[model samples]
Target: MKVSTIEPAQPLDHLAPAGRIGVVALATDFNIEQDLRRMLPGDTQIFTSRVRNYNPLTIENLRSMAPGISAAADTILPGTQLDAIIYGCTSGTVAIGSERIAELIHQSCPGVPVTNPVTAAVAAFRQLGARRISILTPYTEQVNCEVAELFQRHGFEVLNIAGFGFEDDTAMTFISPVDIVNAAKNVCDAQADLLFVSCTALRASVVLDEIEAQLGKPVVSSNQALTWHSLQLLGYPAPVSGYGSLLQQLPV
Candidate 1:
């Protein structure tokens, strides 16, 4: 028998040389991971961990996820570098508050840029110069009101907000793209400068452009905004097109 050690033929490049992103998704969410991965650059790497969440979606249920936030963030590439960390919940972000979410994530990832759907949506709207926005969600009126208030606090006019009155997160993922488009079109205010489809559970990314072309206004979805903002934070140069104007309009 013989044993030998030899030098490698070539030096190895860094893992995820293009970029690496961390996603803290909800235990009940079924759409955010795939939607975000599909929209991110081909060379970019995605790492995801799920936080515990209560169903029958309500403000109380959403806020219940707060305790698991730091644990979920810590599991994703611990002691390593991630360009950004995304807490992939729109209502949950509103429920727990974005500042607190960032603080929780930073408890583990310390200084890594943290983003959520609501924060990402605000940045998307600001980048597109949209002050008047109409919203579509899969939550009940109570959750919808909180989302509206969050945006209002950011100084954007909430033209209108409509919801599917869904209580289960799994059911929200099953919402058909056609139905989402129809609801978005109907819910959007005539005077709105943009339409925001709010929910990580809703599969809205595939139809963002379709709705935009029909309504002649920019469309931003939860997963779309999160991925777009992560890419921007990473300073990835390539433009991600076909989803919506929010992704394509990356700053130079």
Candidate 2:
């Protein structure tokens, strides 16, 4: 598993030469487009679809809207030439369950590869050889507990779990990168093999390097893990840096 760092590359000189990625977002308030613009290669084109007012940070909301969100994603992604499509909601993926969501995306896009953030996180944990995980999020207690249960059901041990008790998914984007690092440190423990900062709205990538150094362990965030996984599925090696050990160490 050789990891590559994200460095300055040649900018896209042609408008239509690069591949396109479609992301179907569950929440209207997330700033994923802005953050991904900074992280992804300049050659890639990103397209987004937003589900109106849907929030996965709450268990009741997540449970109520999983099907609708998946259906919305399916409906919004057709007729586009997407190399891949990613479901941008981590908890939504978990709430609906990965296999079902993957099935829906495949049914919608036919041959195109489909991915979700939660599936990516699980893959990242496995690739990092992490068995005991410390989970952190900007979700309510119910959502956080559900996330822990989801992980445990998937065979990973949740050594610890904590969250910021935020019910507003969109408001999570305002949490600064420094605060994200601090929150991770607050919930992380020596018993855990990895720290999972679970939220796409938070600017986890901006502080991944610092957090990994402080914890001396791999730190994975929803967006970072999904980005890494999405690239891998697109047949590109993980070649990004300034994040953390997961991105630094390529998945096997």
Per-residue CA lDDT of candidate 1, range 36-73, in tens?
Answer: 87898878888999999887889998888898999999
Candidate 2 lDDT tens digits, 1-252: 999898669875554234567787765555677766666666776677766445445655666665555556666546766787788878777777777767766666677778888888999999989899999988888888889999999899999899888887878888887788888889998899999988778888888889988998899988888777777776665477666777665533
User: Candidate 1: lDDT of 211?
Assistant: 98
Give per-candidate clash totals. 0, 2
For all candidates in order, the CA lDDT equals 0.91, 0.77
The best candidate by lDDT is: 1
Query: Listing every candidate in turn, what is its Cα RMSD in Å to the true structure after a full C-alpha superposition?
Result: 1.3, 8.9
Clashing pairs in 2: 6-240, 6-241
